[model samples]
Target chain A: MTSVLKLMGMKSMNSKAAKTPLIPYLFWILLFVIAPIALILYYSLLDLNGNFTLANYAKFFTPIYLKMTFSSFWYAFLITLFTLIFAYPTAYLLTKTKHKKLWLMLIIIPSWINLLLKTYAFIGIFGLYGPINALIEVFGFNPKQILFTDFSFVFVAVYIFIPFMIIPIFNSLDKMNPSLVFAARDLGASAWTTFRRVVFPLTIDGVKAGIQVTFIPALSLFMITRLIAGNQVITLGTAIEQQFLVSQNWGMGSTIAVFLIVFMALTMLVTKQNSKGGRA
Target chain B: MRDLLQATVAIVIVCGLLFVAAGQMQSKGSTGSKDTLTVFNWGEFIDTDLIKKFEQETGINVIYETFDSNEAMLTKVQQGGSAYDIAVPSEYTVESMREDNLLIPLDHTLIPNLKNINDDFLNLPFDPNNEFSIPYFWGTVGIVYNPNLIEDHLTFETWDDLWDESLKRKVFLVDGSREVIGMGLNTIGESLNVKDDKVLRQATDKLMTLSPNVKAIIGDEITPLMINNEAAVALTWAGQAADMMAENEELNYAVPEEGSNLFFDNMVIPKTSKNIEGAHKFINFMLDQENAAQNADYVGYSTPNEAAWDIMDPEVIADERFYPSHELREKLEVYENLGLTWLGKYNEYFLEFKMNLN
Candidate 1:
């Protein structure tokens, strides 16, 4: 009886030890992530009149704001899709290469530079007097107005975000079980089938991670959009910025910010659900 | 397998946590340095050489920063806990700052070159007797256009040209409420600082009509837009207009017959500044005739100081964009503060107008 009691006590002590690690985990989540989000939510409810009001949220539902929000998402979606298409081949090649580290560095070195600098570099490459236009003019084409357009904005955004997608896809590809490919091939599956059925499924998490990284930042970015698109194409980010800077309507700005946060959260939830389903 | 999956999740979570911690630490570290003077001014408005010169002369390092709009400058300054030593705010902001007690009064004796500023710019409505601020630069807001692109020999004589249907998606306006709304008000024979709600509404309605023609609403680097031929016309300040004209002779700056708003960006010692003496020294040095001429030449803006103008290059002084005709000067109106009560209304209507643009 004493031995059995001792065994039970040891089991309880082991369980307590196992649970102790959760304290640091909870502390990190609560401190780093939860606090600022809570503050943002709090700030969102306050109105421009210095009174707590739901009017900001009501204002957000107006057709104009809704349209702006829709456009923001649409642009972000296009950026993500383009990034995925561009990144896939590069990621696959990087993973298949023997000198993976060097190739990875080549892919990611641009990201190490300041985002603003990279955007400005594109201005030099794609602006009206930029090299591309100069080259086109030399080829007997009229100088194209490439800068300050929606197309330029998307092009710059995709270029900046491509690495974000590539890195994650490369990571998942790196960790992928090589045997799965061989197993499918041995079963008389073609190379396309092996990739489609085996490699793609295993790397869905990376794709989802890449999408989250690219899409969210693209949505929040006002600088690149403003610089490349020249305020012709207004996004929710720019609108929020205008509310804060030009209007000085902190209440309205906070409201728009909260709405964005909610929309982002909803997207994250959907993606998480999709990721879980993919895992299953 | 479950344990391994849990471990991988744990590692990912830890990495994310570290990233957040590092970001927070870096931000905090960049801030909270007591000796640094965080100055927020208009982009390319100041001579960075002057700041470096000030640091070398006084040994008080300035952490210079810039903003494109007075509203943006105000928003950050209002956040209030940061130690910004000096800010180059426009005339109206100087008024607002004085009323809010956000500015520290200048000790005129400390700024010896206060004598160098033209007497006309000193005793303005924003700060009568130059108590709270020192004038940095002054100019009028007007229209800039490429002569090559305009079909007609359109002299751009009036603000009404902005509303012309032919200019749709070819015109660019400054993304500024005061400038745009003031232009609208002037076109309709109202004061730029109209406090009357009906007059403001009229202006707003008029401006909304011009929205179809507006390709972009921008603040800085408007020169590139005109130079690149992306825009046929732009509403801009004298400095940007002069810069564009310098790059391309086809560009011309014009003040509307309806009149335009005159603005002065002044350097004020903020209440939060620790180095008031250093700030004063910096202001005086900047006001020195040679320094002022260099600044004016570099920024492509007109100087209010006759002494500085005399020292400026004959070519720059002769540039019509920088030096408007006496008749045109007579027609320009300086912006006046509308006080706190009317400011709220101004903000409200501006918000509504911007929302309607969408």
Candidate 2:
């Protein structure tokens, strides 16, 4: 692609006098990314008539919406916490297992399916007449309603997002120098101590990266919450979709989007500082 | 230097091909022709064969596009560049579109087959006088219940049964603002279009009463549950209920005595349409009895074409889920576009209700 572009009178980057290759990317970012965000910010600050106003944000900060914001954060935090507990050990075992590549591939295979499809598959399995309920019934228990409940909501969220958490942790774990554990062991550290002090510290970067990816998306989760939790779960993403689609409140939708961007930025900053502290 | 010229020519050719491909994709009708009619509608709502047949018969190439929602369709048409010759929007959306003057007054002279529409479906408050739109497919918002499961709990007669505490966790409400809240309004004997704040509050409270019993607020996902007998009762559209009832013997549908939402999707020519004649041709073609019946059967939605009744199967005509009896028909109210302010209020209450669930 670069060769094709270069041949079409685009300046080659090899020459010292050549313009920075970042120019095209900068233009793209300006047009698609920055401009849309700028437009959203502009919309956020306006009423429906295109007049300047901050009432959109004020409307968003009402007690109900505030509750929605806190609930979104809480759900995201829980998803992040659950994914960390479930994925860290699984990723660690993945590194130890024979055919690690195959096992890693197997772990990632489900994510290759569409997110909607994955949620639907879980819905079928979690429904009252589903296989799990069928098995429970065979053993004499009444079939349970797993779906449209908090448990299934979090379960499906974790299922869809575990790969995102695992991949980053796996990358950091794989990159860890195995000799650090040996060094800690030779210094009379027990297996648990070695893991806690050396191995855990080493994987902190991956864990931070993992949390950054998983937690951010979880904050804005819409489809899974609706499908698995049956509109019983309302995250910020659902609110944004409703505003734009159902309510036709472009101003309010843009206002919520702007807040989400701030939330994501604050989260990234917190993780970035924590990782720096961990390394220190 | 020679290779550079050759490479530049290759790049130009590739760019030209991409430009051409994009142009073709955007234009529903073949390039720059008066013989093309562009149509926008819901995805899979129309059978492709019908479009092909229309194209073949008129030699007017059809450019077909689809939208998932009426809001998205309005947004596209409002943006003013796509130039769709026709769009099919739901009942409430047609009102908004007409009010905004986004649609053109149809020349009934061009579409004489407008007579095919059932008198009951005509002169709807949304497009009264049949000026801007023609009825496409119509259905009612009603209850689809499993007789086997609810035999002992409660009799399903009035909208009040949906709120029965004895059937807690066995009911599924359709995931829409208008349908769910409209049921509440109906149960309280208020008009479905009640915009009074006091009435709206009462309706919200009534909805809250049923909140504990709702297993899920769902859309198309209710179909599988209804068919599989996982849900005892689901408030769903007539089309969906009819389809599910066909598969599940024990399942029955009811248009409660209090009243329910009877909605229709209408075909309209947008103000920006470039092929008015072709648009009329397409609408007229679709209204033909045989064609209307074929499209209805294919799409599994009820048709408003009275002529279609002649060609349709007796079983479909007898299916009360799709065709309500005269008494039930009197109790059914067509959904009105509650305008923007009321729409926002409804959305707020609906969101609050959903949030209160957990």
Candidate 3:
């Protein structure tokens, strides 16, 4: 970052040669990010016959799609909420722990395993004959079906999202100036009051970042619903997958995606406050 | 600062060269004079050993590609820039492809062993007189239960039998719109392909009521769950049921006496087939009774080849539960290609039923 600023301050920053480094980044944005989105937008305007039509968008506005979207948002909200609830504490605790980096690495290592493998592991763990049920059996209760329940669905999604939610929060909390905490205590502020005002407000950017990573993926990363919820849940991600893969309705899928992107943009706008103030 | 910029430029240049090199390699693939027969089948659906055998004997390089669903397969075939010598699509998909002129009619002269296919499978409504597709394997959607886990396993004789109050939260339905809704339609004494929205709505309502018995509508995970006695009763394809039954001595499959979907996955030469002769040879090799029997056993699907049955294990051929008799086959309904609108409605109703579950 300092080098970037240093480059900006240099006279060469204004010259054509200085722009060379930005080319690769710009190319990446154009090819991988912008191009695919543009294609999806184009596909959204086409009907089954490849004829130009706004009917897909019109259909998306209907009660069925809207209700699905609402429920998907509700699920994503629950997942994000649960993730934050668990993650904020873990991240804070880790910041105070000895060898915090090692602890953070340990937390992240499980996430490095293939997502499908992790989801598959949960199937065994939550199965009717699985450990949870076995435990229930040992406790003099009848074994219960746990794999397909809403509780399992939300639990697995929250589990998957915790690491993502933690890293950003851990970064921001770790970066906080500790003297402000001491200063707050010196001023006779209660610990709770100090945390609320002095700690949390200063690390709002990290919380926002945490929400950005967890909430957005939670909205779309719904394959776990299929594996864990047993296809009882129809998340927007599942709907999109069904349309594109099962129904072969690219137009409808793209329409849903376009709305998702729009909503995600709105989410970012709402969550992200004035960055200049947030950093301060 | 200069070192960093130079490093970034060098990395970018290397990436650009790599992409160009990859493109060249890709473009070079089409130029090969080597005899390559590309077969697009369901992912892990076929016996890989048979592919190696065909390649070894026929001297044609077997390039196997796969798709998860018929719709996804249809999209690839419809997209049409690339050529696949053979494709295995379900019965309804074959109908759609035939209508869309996506498949080329087979040359019987090259596929001489095609005669081994059972008469029961051929000249069906979908591809009359074996016009485009050869029945690769046929199976029915049925209830498979672990007898040890349930008291009255025989009570699962019909689709309606699944709703028994005794089987509370013990059922796992296959996670497919058609199969689940078809079970609903069949339970109400309607055809699996019932199109009328009114009747469809009835099936949807009926299925929704079975929420008590339905533990989960899961997919391939059903095999592991059922084998380990996780759930007592599961609605699954005969092939998958065979897999579970093979693994667990306690498991048994029954095609509900009332009705069920008899799905056929057939091999067809797509219009874009570059090696038509090679495709025919591959098909003929697979159609050989020994090969067909071997594949049927390995892949856990019912061989449509009648000749293969004589060569198969006597015990297997005797399993009326897995491969039903003529009377049972008559009762088994084959799903038709309900055009986009109706298919979409089927999925919608299924999705609605799913949404109402929570």
The runs of at least 3 residues in candidate 1 whose Cα sits more than 4 Å from the true structure, single-residue gaps closed, are A1-19, A22-28, A138-140, A178-196, A273-280, B1-40, B48-63, B80-82, B163-169, B195-213, B225-230, B313-320, B325-327, B337-358
lDDT of 2 by residue, A175-277 (tens): 8888988999999999999988888887888898999999999999998878889888889899999888887888889999989988887787677635353
**What lDDT score belongs to each candidate, Candidate 1 first?**
0.78, 0.84, 0.86
At residue B152, what lDDT does model 3 achieve? 66
1 or 3: which has the higher DockQ? 3
* Top-TM-score structure, candidate number: 3
Of candidates 2 and 1, the better by lDDT: 2
Give RMSD to native, each candidate. Answer: 7.7, 5.5, 4.5
Candidate 1 chain B: 10-residue stretch with minimal lDDT:
B26-35
Which candidate should be chosen as best, given DockQ against the real structure?
3
lDDT tens digits by residue: candidate 3, B1-358? 6765787778788989999987775564455515887889987688899999888897888888988779888988888756788999999999999999999999888888988988888999999998898999999999899877777645578677788888888898887889999988988899888889999999999999998888888878888888888889999999999989889988888887888899999999998787787888888999999899999988888888999999899899888987888888998889999988788778878878887776
User: Model 3: per-residue lDDT, tens digit, A1-280?
Assistant: 2332353357345666766666656577678967887899999999877999999989887777888899888888999999999999999999999999999999999999999999999999987678888899999999776888888999998998899999999999999999999999999999999998889888888888999998888888668888898876778888888888777778888989988887787787678655574333
- Residue pairs with clashing backbones, model 3: none
What clash pairs does model 1 have?
none
Q: Which regions of candidate 3 are displaced past 4 Å? A: A1-28, A278-280, B1-28, B151-154
Output the lDDT of residue A59, model 1: 77
